[model samples]
Target: MAIFRKPGRSGQPKPTPEPTPGQVAEELAELVEELEEPTAGGPADGGPSRQVVEYEAEYRAERGRRRGATLVASIAKLIGAGSRSAAKGAAYGGRAMADQLMQAAPRIPVRNLATLRAQHPTAADADRLAALLITGASRASAALGAGVGAAAMLPVPPAMAVEIAAETLAVAAVEIKLIAELHEVYGVRAQGNVTQRASAYVAAWANRRGIDPTLLVKPAGLAAMALGAEVRQQVRKRLTRSTLRRLPSLIPLMVGAGIGATVNRRDTRKVGRQVRDDLRSRRPAAAAYWSAAAPALPGETAP
Candidate 1:
């Protein structure tokens, strides 16, 4: 696939060149302008420490405003982008999506866990950082969903499913980044080189849990090995199911933007909460450790 290739130079997964952090900063600036607001999340570099206390509030409030726009503006956005997308899309096939995930896995940005801790220096720092990444991912998926949702509304041949598949790959990048970074915050590192770690995190994201250490035990030349059909199959199944779950966004009714936005938001939040809980279950003292650092997260108000 275009995004991944065979390992280079005697057998190490050649690290994907990092997209300039400036690119992320610029895109985020535009997103904030388009929505007239803010949100937060993990680094594009894949570390778990970030400052997201403020953006979460804005995203939580965006649903109601988008609900009001569902009848006109949101629909307008979807249809307008269809023609351009149609030119690039192909006939959607199951294998197409599976291939996309395989390609996307290695591109997920993940920072070294030890480095992430050294940079932040506290357990609570990780939680606050994970919050930003989690919320940032939620917003990123919603934006992709909106565009795909829009493309689907147009009577553009088989382009709708094709567009959906493309955006599925994009959202997978965002979520995979979140999942891998979350592992750092919980102090459980997925073992391996670049592509190997991405594969393990892809499985965790699809399986919707903390990284299974057992999956990380591959030895010697295994780091450069391609992911087996079993891993690819699980990712394919998860992506297809997640895409189908967004169908409610197609309803031209009151639920329009609200449904997709709400579902994506709630679901990502659930993934964050669940994974954190599961990891904490393994290290019951994690929360207590962070709790001692700060009673509440920055910008996390009294509830």
Candidate 2:
């Protein structure tokens, strides 16, 4: 009986043609050269293969900037405007603090679903990614106000108080990024451009809850959010709470710094986890949209 190979749809696998002596040496030399060359990712199935660049470096740089700004702002927050009316101290302080947040908000690099899925291919991985951000930001936030309170008490100028405010703003930005990215991870894309989306995120921060998608849209398609009386009241209340929470960071010396950092880290994790739980319940809808646009979430259940 003679052995034979079957012809599959693509035909029989090609039988290796024995190489000539010269061809063998050429192939061997090419193989040596290939092995010696620096290795890098080649095209896979015609798609460009690239790894997600972890943002740790950028995060560090931004944290350093925040720490410096916090020091400067600390003085301003305490002394208030030198030439302004004494009656204006409270109002001016509030306005200046708000201004810090306004500046920091846009600087937050809230990765969208595409970037997230590229970096974190699974739900579990995404969770770790969020956790990493929270932890890193918490450390930075803790560092921002460290010893500044004690520094304020010294013969130094009024800038130290504002540093506390700056630390709070920086921490808020970090948490806001975590919140917004969590929304993206869960498949919910907030309406409008970056600013509008950020406003919605700020609302979530104000409320400490996940956004209601229906409310993300408004009749005035161009308007980001009305911030009507009720919304204003809500934001005011949230800010008040935040201010109260920040009091401890003003503690001077190593003790205050330790407490401030601990509180910030704990609170941030609590907020992140709470928002994640809320989003998880409402994930399927957004997951469907994202699944169509990107990869599926690991272990995502059917809608």
Each candidate structure's TM-score, on Cα atoms with residue i matched to residue i, is 0.60, 0.61
Q: Summarize candidate 1's per-residue lDDT along 1-303 as a digit string, tens digits.
A: 124666988797776444333343233323322332233446765733455544555555454233222322222223232566456544444566667556646654565444444334443466666665566667655665554454344443445545455545555666677687777667666666777777777777778898765554563323543457777778878878776776666654334455666776677777877777677656522344433333334677422
Model 2 Cα lDDT, one tens digit per residue, 160-186: 344555455556666777788788767
For residue 220, give model 2's deviation from the true position in Å.
4.2
Q: Give Cα distance to truth, residue 213, candidate 2, Å.
A: 2.6
lDDT, each prediction: 0.56, 0.54
lDDT of 1 at 71: 21
Over 4 Å off in model 2, which ranges? 1-96, 99-107, 120-126, 147-157, 217-226, 286-303
